[model samples]
Target: MKSVFRKILLLFITVCTLFVVLKWDLIRYGWQQARGQIAIMYNAEPLAHFLENPSYPDSLKAKIKLVEKVKTFANAELGFSSESQYEKMFDQKGKELMWVVTAALPYSLESYKWNFPVLGEVSYKGFFIEKEAIKLAQQLTKKGYDVRVRTASAWSTLGWLNDPLLSNVLNLSNGRLAELILHELTHDEIFIKDSIEFNENLASFFGQEFTKKFFKKQLERYASELYDYLLHLEDRHTLNKFVRNYLPRFDSLYQKIEGLSTIEKENQKFYLIEKFKQDLRNQKFKNPKYTDFIKSEIDVNNAFLLSYKRYSGHQELLERKLQTQFDGDIGKMLDFYQKNYDSL
Candidate 1:
């Protein structure tokens, strides 16, 4: 029995050693992410603490109260999870928490996916260290992948850890703040494995729809807020329409250039991208919000375009289905997907 036990222990040690040797990069990346998550969890304080703290600013406290109301509304009215998420606050102290890196083929809309332990396959990866994200982007770019790196203010743990309301989120307008809270909560409600685009679109749809309902119920007092939110929605609609109309043109451009040299293809790709930006500049918007967004906010590469599609591609379809088939019942629409996602 002693000899058998010793052999098993030796085998286990050897296997672990081999895994570390072969997957050192993955281990390192996971360790960085774990450290970042652990830091946030450790620093988080319960909402009651901040609400009761005399030294805390009244303005921030009010935002905290608004968050509490939003969470309750999402749970009691919208049928999202009643988990302990957003019950705590994480003060970022004006520093970004994570940077997300997304990559795609330069000539096609296909995303460059990374396979992980539990997430299976994902199109984007997050880094706690910005430099590390930049390093990865450089490497992918060298390999001819179009890479986009952007800062993320909030994320969900899928109930694994109680997510905290980030301080930056409090700075958004009242309507946007509510939407952001509901959007993250939607992840807790349902997440389909390996289908990042579908999961994101579902969350976006519910988030926007729930926000509309919340403001509508309070419109007597929040009329101005609702108007502002509607304007924001209109701008979003305009951007979505632009992308929907132009993405096919991009696809056609790529298809026609299949026989071109790599350098030649890259030149043409960027030329077309500049033309797209010019067209965006020429269009009149309902608000000045997208002017800066078009000029400098985004890199407007294949990865960026696909990122928009990932979040909003199926929104109209989902909205139509909700109205026509589900009788405009968001709860029933959610139930159908929760039960039928695998088949989808």
Candidate 2:
């Protein structure tokens, strides 16, 4: 019996060693992510603690209260699950918490995807360490893929962990803050595997719709603010339309260059992209808020354009469904989607 037990222990140790050897990269990445998440959770303090701390500013306290109001509205009215989210806060202390990297074929709109265990396939990879994200982006660029790296304001853990409100976001205006919170809550309520575009579009649609309702409920107090926000939404809508209109043209251009050399194809791609940026700059918008945004797209590539498409592609269809099928009832639409996400 002693000899048998010793043999079994040796086999167990060997198996674990083999597993570690086989999955070192994944294990290391998982450890990095887990460590970052744990650090945030450990540093977070309950909302009450901050509210009661006299050293905390009144302005920040007001934002904290606003966060609570947004969460309550999302739960009671928009039918999103709270699940203890936003009950605590993490101070980013002026640093970005995460960076997301997206990649695409230089000559095509096809997004490069990353597969994880439970989340399945996702088009973007997130890194808690900025240098890690930049390293991946550099590697992808060397591999001839168009890559874009941007700071992420927030992301859902899909209910795996209670997400805390980051201190950096408290600088957003009330309406913008409400939109951000509602957007994340939508993810908590409904997520479909391997359908990132649909998930993001659904969240954005609900975030905008619910924010409108949230402001409309207190129109007397936020009428001007609501009006300005609506104009901002209009600018975004116009931009989405502009991008949608150009997608087919981009596809056509790519198809036209099928037989060209790689260098020639890249040249043509940038030429067209430059032309598109110029046209975008020439367009009239409802607000001047996007002037700097338009200028930033001068370096736009397939990855950047496709990233925008992921969030806005299905928005019109969702809006039509909301108005026609759900009679503009956001909650009912949410319920239908939540019940039928697998089919979607």
Q: Please give the lDDT score at residue 3 for candidate 1.
A: 100
lDDT of the structure predicted as candidate 2: 0.87
Error of 2 at 230 (Å): 1.0
RMSD to native for every prediction?
2.0, 2.1
Q: Kindly list the per-residue Cα lDDT of model 1 for residues 1-344, writing each as its tens digit.
A: 99999999999999999999999999999999989888888899999998999998898898898788878887788766745888888888888888999999999988999988877788899998999999999999999899999999889887677888888888888878888888888888778789899889999999898888888877897788789988888888888878877999899989989899989998998899888988887766777767667666457888989988889999889989999999998878878877876521
Candidate 2 weakest lDDT stretch, 10 residues:
290-299
Over 105-193, each residue of candidate 2 has an lDDT whose tens digit, in order, gives 98889999988777789999888999999999999999999999999888788766799888999888777888899898888888888
Clashing residue pairs found in predicted model 1: none
Q: Which candidate number has the best TM-score? A: 1
